[model samples]
Target chain A: MKGLAELGEFGLIDHIRARFPQPVAPELGIGDDAALLSPSAGRQVVVSTDLLAEGVHFDPGFGPARLLGRKSLAVNLSDLASMGAIPRWFFLSLAIPAGFSLETIEGFLDGLAEQAAEHNCILAGGDTCGSKGGLTISVTIMGEQRPELILKRSGAQPGDDVWVSGSLGDSALGLKLLMEGVRLGGAHDPLLLRQLDPTPRCELGLKLAEAGLVNAMIDISDGLLADLGHICEQSVCGAEILLGQLPLSPALYTCSSKQPVFPWPLVISGGEDYELCFTAPRCNREAIQKISKTAGIPLTVVGKVTNSRQVQAILPDGTNFQPSASGYTHF
Target chain B: MKGLAELGEFGLIDHIRARFPQPVAPELGIGDDAALLSPSAGRQVVVSTDLLAEGVHFDPGFGPARLLGRKSLAVNLSDLASMGAIPRWFFLSLAIPAGFSLETIEGFLDGLAEQAAEHNCILAGGDTCGSKGGLTISVTIMGEQRPELILKRSGAQPGDDVWVSGSLGDSALGLKLLMEGVRLGGAHDPLLLRQLDPTPRCELGLKLAEAGLVNAMIDISDGLLADLGHICEQSVCGAEILLGQLPLSPALYTCSSKQPVFPWPLVISGGEDYELCFTAPRCNREAIQKISKTAGIPLTVVGKVTNSRQVQAILPDGTNFQPSASGYTHF
Candidate 1:
């Protein structure tokens, strides 16, 4: 807690384990050399990783460690949701800058525990060190799903319905307010909540997977249109979206309040919105509605997959529009 | 190779895989989210992680990426050897500073592949990213052995004979030559190779484990005295080692051109000597010799364990002493 070297390797691990949910994996957790988790039946494993750097992905001045931890774990889980897998274990390797306090690490772990418990997952193992400056958190998540039901970005077919769960763009709007020196101050804005703690569409993913309805899936981390493009590229298909029907938080308009910035910017290019963007065949449309009903998530028909290998956006007047940059790039 | 964003995630991974060995562990290898490796039967897994910061661990001015990769993998493998575990799987996560050349990344991966092939180990799964500044490499390794045969730093009993493989101080001396503008040309001086590419004692470890001769095991990562002191503190025992018996490469004296300058400083305080420091019960004295003979590694007896729980260096006259400053500390 005081100095990383002072705790030594095993002592430091014990210190960290005290703050996390003891990974329920049977064979080994932190004491031994490696962890062991049995594979689930009729399922193939799914994995994904994300690295979050201080000062880039987050600003310590306003982005507290808890929120950073929450967001870090959420992003990886969202990836698993894209594959319709059940996230069960995580390995976190954290590099803390010297300026960071033990309290900061604890706050991060606290958020990790809270979010992990929501989906019955646990922190299985990790490596920690003191960096020269600025913190870095790298997390790798392991999940599993039935082979037939495993959703992939490359599985979307022509004529499939493009769908998304719950709301979008709120997280982007929240960032705009933060940049504009708008203090949330406990304001009644779902946009602020979305930014601080965007929910992973785990329930909806499981519901759809169980019902065997979705064709292909991806988490909307890099905004809607850009991610949709990725799905189209992988699936060898194209898509067309009715942009006028883009979902947005009413609170976004209320907060932006006559700033002609066009809500489309937030609705389309907003990253960190961990909602599921998926494609479903027309035959499964009713089943998808039932998934939304069962999971209590709003499933909106956003677009349709097309035969042509190009993505086009249409206005209410059937006008096509083009945007220069597509999505987030972590270079 | 270039910017990770430019290569795209899958492209970068493909580039890496093209260079590394295809894993024989058919169950888990690259391309998956996480790898699943079967540990040796009846053996408990021994796990350890090490972080190599660009500035802290290597000086790019003199450090080759291939050597860095090999050394990074070797350090983790060294930890496994210290625990008498048969090194098996490695998970590497690297963060390279932006604009780092493709040649540099390729060179590093080449070095990693060379070591993996030599050690009979597999590269499982890992994450790669572009950092804001310096590169940071983190490796987690898993080794397995019979649960009861697995050695620990806390298992040495009083009167056990202390032993070490290979030599001490050579790698540190090699590093000094590399950094201090003393390059010996024409593939001479094995010391330089030891410094740049420290060979892990994984084979020696398996021999010791199979022979059931080791009582305690540790890799001499920090100076010999500092590392042995760890065993003393954890096992609640003491050691009295003859200072003059420390191993030194003839090349060191040949390179330095000095009358040893108190060999204790080089042997007791120098670091990066990836040799195995361990203890074996006095009854297995002959077994230790047989292990060394069969494994083709010299095993030099250095000291004996005691009930005192204090570590003392035996002067030529057999008087006891201790080093002034211990070992490496990152914090």
Candidate 2:
């Protein structure tokens, strides 16, 4: 395959346009100056944008280009999922270095296409250009949901039960292993996959939103405590978390038993989990439990909202728990 | 002022969110995982995304940070203008290098706010992160328009008169002077300002769309001939332009007389002019002229659409004209 420079910008655009055909009717997709979409009647639009730089977000040599592509879209989809919106379309802008092979670009797009297809999202419009440095990918995803059903971080009230979907800390631990150059062999290694290709809990979020069970919701991208602090700050409340109730995956436990060092703090402060964390009134606990069973995702009660206006964690032995680092800092 | 590293990502975000306050209702602005917007009744949505890398798009040392900020949003707004949509909201994702001063970022945002305020567009949501290399800014702009009022490049027909708004070639000429190390005095130099801060033709586009006077419309970001070729290709037609009809700015002529280097080819092949080019039926020429007079812009007929599928130019001497270069190539 020819390199990106050899393919030229127009050829690369044509290749991408061919991969994602335009949708029929009311919306005009790619190949135009801009995309035209008819917003669904009675629904509000949800939008989010994210940037993933080469060295800052991911190391190209550490993971497959396909996984990077999946992760790029997955991260933005998680934002929409957190808002309980149904993914519909996305715009991708990429800055590719001169040295990038066309195969690498294809692999990345293939992975992105697979994820978009899973969510029935369409490629609307985008821009591509040469980069003097490493590859930079920026994505803007759009979704739609009923206005009244929209959940916001400011909706949490004191005395509400705090809950989390799925396990935590696996992705942070996976990143640690990868940074230390520990390859667990197969591509399907559970821990490595958790870091490389985290799933957006769209189904669970939709189910919870439709059931009207959650008062407030957020995706756990910046670890548990930091993100919970965001909710507490906005809702003008506090929370008390039981450290023992934090869900740790079997893969994390197995790795910890084999290694001398245990990554305990990662459960609360590590990032890139992409799981849903929400609060609900205790009266709706049974309904949430039924939703968890139907959605096939584990729902764990980790804490309760409080009036103290501070986020504090309690250890299993009844001592105050503190982490060395709060979460990932961009700067 | 301190560098970006000293401000930290969250502090920078807070700084930005403070500048652009959220709208009163019907739309949720920044400080959230995703932004929620209610689309206007009976209006379709329009979207466009663009990326600008530091080295590829601009040289920071040669221009003011405020102009770069203005240009960043201006280019995306031009896309919405080309589609005849009313600008509403935009998402910005920036990758800022560690050494960038806080003043530079604030300057850029100030210029962006100026342009956004002029168009009545709001900053909905965005992501800011650290960059290993130079600054990379990506923007996704959204707008709304009635389905029937939207303009596209695929609507031109044979016998249509091709028209362009405002003058051309001045920006390209100005860029040539700057590249040659010719700083033409103050910040208000007309040529330099034309190149550094081009305006989007939103008013003219809206008037044409509202009057239903144009068969096709496109923004001249990729030069006159190349962008005209886009309309021809999509509309399945050809164009024959008259060289004498090309509108050259007085600044270009003055610079040419002083430099003794005539850049005539730039009139048809240069990029980044951000002017509107369209085609209308011969019968509606009077109406278009009336629109031009009412909108306070110069609308000139530069060519005519043909049944054949080739874009050709005729010199004033009644001979065929061929440009030295077609247009700007991204890669």
Candidate 3:
């Protein structure tokens, strides 16, 4: 394989464009000075950006370039989902090491295009540069929504029902399994799969927003306690979590059974699930449940908003529980 | 005095927000799930992202974090300037080391705010993470322009006159001076200032686009020859450069006079100038000249579009000259 330096910057960009042709051509995308985006009339754009640095975010020994690229965009898309916005366009800025192989770069971009196609998101424009440090992938995603349909964290009120879509702690367990050198044969391992590629709940979010079933929402990138805390802080309320009501996959339960203390820390404080934690009026529980079934996503009632100002966890036996680890933090 | 990790993610974000408050507040900037942008009706949004990696893009000894932050945003703004777009909102993703001080981060954010206020660009959203490598700043800027007035690289005609705003090669000379450990005392040094903070010709670009004088446009970041090559390639045309007519800053000319040979390569192929290189019909020359004066930017006629499909540079003695180097490339 030819080294990256041989192709130079423009040549590498041409190679990338050839490998990842846009399914839906942007008004102005690659090969131009800047990308052009025309928003629908009366639509408000939702924008978010995330940066993933090597060593800090992932271990190269476990994460391949292709999966890394897919996960990077997936994380940003998750932010859009949290806001109840439809994923539309994205921009990528890559800082690749000098000696990195062109083949690896191709694989990364191919994965990005694959993910973009699946979500109908267009890769608008990006910049690539050589890095003296480890590889860094920065992605900015732009989503669109009607102003009235936008979900925010400050909308939750006391007496609202707290719900989370999908199971929690799976991704955190997946990371642990990877660290322990436990490979259950490629993507067949549910834990490893969750860690490497968690799907963003874009459809479910949009449905909830359109139906007005949810008042406040956020994606669970951090652990349940910390993320729920954000809603609590913004909504000016508290929350109470019933430990027995937490939605956990059987695989995670089985993995926890083998541990000495049943891994409650991972269950409560795990990060990167990319599931929605939302609050809605308690009176609309039945409607919310119906919508959950229609969306084919299990909506678990984990807790409820309270007048108290602290988040509390209650064990199965009615004993108070407090988590040891809060959530993931960059700083 | 606290390290970044000590402040935690949310705390650090709060600190950053306090220091870099947006003067022109975005509709829903920062906090919450994502930033909100409401584009004016009938306008197209222009988007561009650029990444600057330490060691590869800049040397730590010469590139301070404050200047680097300003330059990072400036580079992305240049892309918008080339498209004749009005700077609107920006997103920044930073990868900093764990032990990085809050003071240094403050300085960087301060510099960013300074530049954003000058252009009326709002800092809408950003992500910060720990890095194992040197600091990296990735910026994505969104601009707005009416569809008809948008400039593109593929609109040059066969008989269009080529013009470059401001002098070329000053940035290259600045880099040379830095490498030689030459400093003329702070911002007073024209060469140093050019290298550290080259101005993007936004006003001139908007004027040309609105007046419908320029047929094609691009920013000269990757040197005159290579950037001009992009326009020629896109427009499916050729260009002829009269080397004698090339605009050179007095500082650059003085620096070249002391060299073994005139530094034509720097003037023709050096990168990071951030000046506008454009093409217009011969009939619009007077209008362009008048607008350039009003904008207070010198518009130099250095070349013209030709029927041939190659970019040719002619020497003062009427001989063809091919550049030994064609610009900087990451690879």
Candidate 4:
């Protein structure tokens, strides 16, 4: 395949434009100075932006280009999901190093296309240029939802049940395994996939928001405790999560049994799960469960919101559990 | 001042969030999973994104941190200006390398805030992280315009008059001088300012679009002929610009007189002018001049749209002129 220099900037843009055909009005997509988007009447626009820098966010040699692209969009989609907005449009800014292969770009686009198609989001507008550093991908995603139905981190009240969707700790463990160069063929592949490819839990988030079941919500990108701390701090309340109640995937359980330590810290504070961690009033438990079942994702109530202004964790045997670090910080 | 590592990532974000207070509803700004924006009724949202990479886009040693920040937003705002959109909100994503000083970041934000206030734009959301490479800034600016009043590059007609706001080649000459380490203290400061801190022709663009005086509009980030070339290609027509009629700033003329070769190539193909190049019908000339007087920016008619499908330049003696290159390409 031809390299990026051979393709040139405009040729690269045309190639990318061809991959993601404009799904909206021809005037509203790529090629314009700016994208013109008409939001559905009365719906508010929701926007979230994230950056993935090489050597900091990802290791180029470890993950496939396709999965890296998928994860890039997935992380931003997770932010929208937490806001309970329907994924609509995204702008991508890529800084690629010189001599990068067009085949790798195509592979990246292939994976990005898959996610965009599944979420029904369009590639609205973006900027691409050569980078003197490693690949840097920045995405700004926009979605729409009725203002009254949107979720925020500041809505939780005392006595609300703290809940989490899917499972936790799998992704962090997966990263650990990958770093150690441990490749367990079949059984542990799920763990590795959890790190490489995360599901954003959009459907479940939409359902919860639509049902008016969630009091506050945030995606578990910075781990359960750290993200929950955000909701607690903003909501002006505290949370106490039970260690025994923390949901662990079957794959995590099977892998942890063979390890020397139980890996509870990874389960507690490890990052990049992309699962929804939210709070709801006690009366909506049955309703939330029904919605989760409908969405085919597990919902576990692991804690309760308290009047105190701190996050506390209880061990299974009734002792207090303290993590060395709360979560990941870029700096 | 503390370095980035001393301040920590969250601390740095808090510092940034404090600088640009949300001018809209409190729920619409930073500190959420995503920013929530309510667009004006019946208006379409216009979005543009641009990336300024270190080394490739800017020389950190040459320009001040404040101007670097200002230029980052100005370039994106130029895209919005070309579309006749009123600036509203912007998202910034910065990848800062380790050991960077907090003072530099604060200085950068100071200049960015100045531009944001001038344009009446708010910082709605963004992401910040540690970078292993040079500092990278990606900005996505969103604006709004009435659907019918928005301008585009595809509207120039065969009989239209080609116009440009402000002068050309000043920024290009400034860059050339800076590269050669030529510093003219007082007389040439305007040229340097033109390159380091470009003023987006937003007001002129809005007036032109609102008055329906322009058929096609684009910001001249990619030089005169190159950007006019965009208008020609997109409008499916050709253009012939008068070389003698090309707008040259007084600073450019003063500097060019001292140089051996006339800088016509830079005038034609230099990038980052941030002027407005547009096409209008012959009938709108009087009205456009009136708007230009009211806006207090020079509006010059330098050419005409033709049925041919190429961009051409004519010398003072009516000879065809050729440019060494069309414009800047990142790759």
Best by DockQ: 4
Better of 3 and 4 by DockQ: 4
Q: Compared with the true structure, what per-residue lDDT tens digits does model 4 show for residues B75-165?
A: 9999999999999999999999988888889889999999999999999999999889999999999999999999998999998999988
Task: Indicate the worst ten consecutive residues by lDDT in candidate 1 chain A.
Answer: A25-34
lDDT of each: 0.74, 0.88, 0.87, 0.90
Give RMSD (Å) of candidate 1 vs. truth.
4.2
Give DockQ: model 4: 0.87
Output the worst ten-in-a-row residue range by lDDT, candidate 2 chain A.
A180-189
Count of steric clashes across candidates, in order: 4, 0, 1, 0
lDDT of 2 by residue, A200-305 (tens): 9988888888888889999999999989898998899999999889888888887778767556678888889999999999999999999889888999999999
Chain B TM-score of candidate number 3? 0.96
Best by TM-score: 4
The DockQ value obtained for model 3 is: 0.84
Candidate that would win on lDDT: 4
Worst 10 residues of 3 chain A by lDDT: A17-26
lDDT of 3 by residue, A171-288 (tens): 9999998998976575438988788878889999988999998989999998888889999998999999998999999899877887787677787888899999999998889998
Ranking by TM-score: 4, 2, 3, 1
Off by over 4 Å in 4: A183-186, B183-186
Residue pairs in steric clash, candidate 1?
A33-B47, A47-B33, B43-B145, B43-B146
TM-score of 2: 0.98
